[model samples]
Target: MTGDGWNAAVRRRLGLGRLLALGGPEDGVWITERAATSVLGAVAAALPGLAVTSLRLAPADPGAAAEPAVPPPPSALPPGPLRVSAEVVALGGRPLPELVAALREALFTAARERLGLVVSDVDVQVTALLDDLPDPPNGGPPPGPTDQPASATATAALTTPGVARLTAELGPPVQTAEGHVRVEVATAPPHHPLEVARAVRTAVGRAAPDADSVAVLITWAG
Candidate 1:
């Protein structure tokens, strides 16, 4: 049998055991709940027959706020919101099974960590695989916001204690030519939107008292 065939066998053996142990569909447990365990199980099942090194979960830092910094004088970085990527690596043989397993695990981890994410499914593409010699380890670029200018008001507003945290935590500000900026603000535990809005209005007035208005866009995170 081909290496691919062996890989499939390994996955099936491991998956069968997991399937047996898991409760039926009626239990309402999500398939994702078992994702990590399934992948690790598959790895263990194939280890004795295959030479495996180690499994690692490496997530890059989210980096500092993207809005505060000025853009570079030159060079090319995509413009817009921040970009983050997650990929799986196998330090073993050319097995489609293991590749799929690792990719799924990586995707699952990303979904849990990244907020406001919508994932259709984890699509695994086997970029590389080696034989007797260990597979080459993979590396991905560090993550940060794309090239964008800091809002004149946002930069200034963040200097304060309460307003600073709210502005920073919310995603990029939505600009309007009307000279009015609308955003959702919250306080410790859970503060009413009206209170947060009042606080923001006060902060903005303090920063730029001349500003026309600071409207609260919505109650929750926008």
Candidate 2:
């Protein structure tokens, strides 16, 4: 294959992993798998002797999932319960199962309480046991605004509660197309991502009353 063709394929594979559902039907929020997994890696870094070597988030069961209340943008994942699959390497300290259990709990707690991700299940695999701790996992790049014309509703989205800033890759932070609004934001902590997204939706709705749907994509959260 041509180098450019290979590069394009790689980009598609890596370009902002899968979108994972963040909240219920009305919330209309999704988070990139890369962003969520990066945060989850940090959660493991904080735990004693546990390192999340890798993680991925995907729809729990697409066939059994109910249709989203509002149709999602073609690029975003359909709203549904999600499952986390992780591989971990542990330092010799605790029972393997016990350590795995703790790792699972940490992922669940962080995903739900801190990020408001609709993570219904966590599957952890202990890949290795180490004699000494490995270097802490590094987070992926933080979300930043994409290069596109900022819509008039940008201010409204930024002014919403819990929104820290806007971030995107291919389009403006705030985008409205065909009565649908797609907002990509970096949310501040102490407020769940879902809550922040919902507020953004409300604010955007007020700003563009004609908008029929809003999809919030959270790029970062403390």
Candidate 3:
């Protein structure tokens, strides 16, 4: 890559923040920062007159989390409680405090219910008082090969007790390379994602016994 290209790539990553643990270190599941932001931003945009201008997440206390039995991905932070900082724009009319309070509660609830994210707190920064509501934005991966390790891994992951479904409507739900197994899943509701992810790991183990490592990324909770 050229100097300009490398700088652009670094800036993009800085904007996305880091991979977030879905439940805990023990769960061994993670979601990309971009995915988490999309979830939270959608919740805010749906509210009557508010819109999220920015949304970011970070470990509430990185030092509190001890080393895990399984290491997290190199780009991921260790499992720990997370803190959310969101900047929102709201149209004038309702009290400002009410708008902030509502957005905060909605975001917190969505983080836990929809994503199974353990958020320590949400800090809302009202960036602007918009004169009107902003227009909402509109919104595939390839199909997985039918044979071999990925197919078997996909089957095992889907059949796992707490996995809800494949995480994305398009792309392959499971991918494998050498000894590494990577899977993305939406877990069944009311089940802690950590438990579900751990189970998926076990299932992957049984299905791909020769595999050296498995990584589960939970993109949704229900």
Q: List lDDT for all candidates, in order.
A: 0.33, 0.77, 0.73
Off by over 4 Å in 1: 1-89, 131-152, 155-176, 179-222
Write one digit per residue (lDDT tens) for candidate 3, span 1-222. Answer: 899978876775564457787776566678767667766777888888787777899888878765544555557777788999998788887688888898889989988877778898899988788788677653122222233233778889888888767654212467667787778777665676667888899998899998877888765544
Residue 181 of model 1, lDDT score: 54
What's the CA RMSD of model 2 in angstroms?
A: 3.1
* Residue-level lDDT tens digits of model 2 in 86-200: 8888887668888888888999998888777777899998888889877876675565544534565787888788888887643567777877888888887667777888888
The pairs that clash in candidate 2 are none
Which sequence of candidate numbers ranks them by lDDT, best first?
2, 3, 1
Best by lDDT: 2
What TM-score would every model get versus the actual structure?
0.29, 0.87, 0.72
Candidate 1 residue lDDT tens string, 182-202: 443222222332333345546
Better of 1 and 3 by lDDT: 3
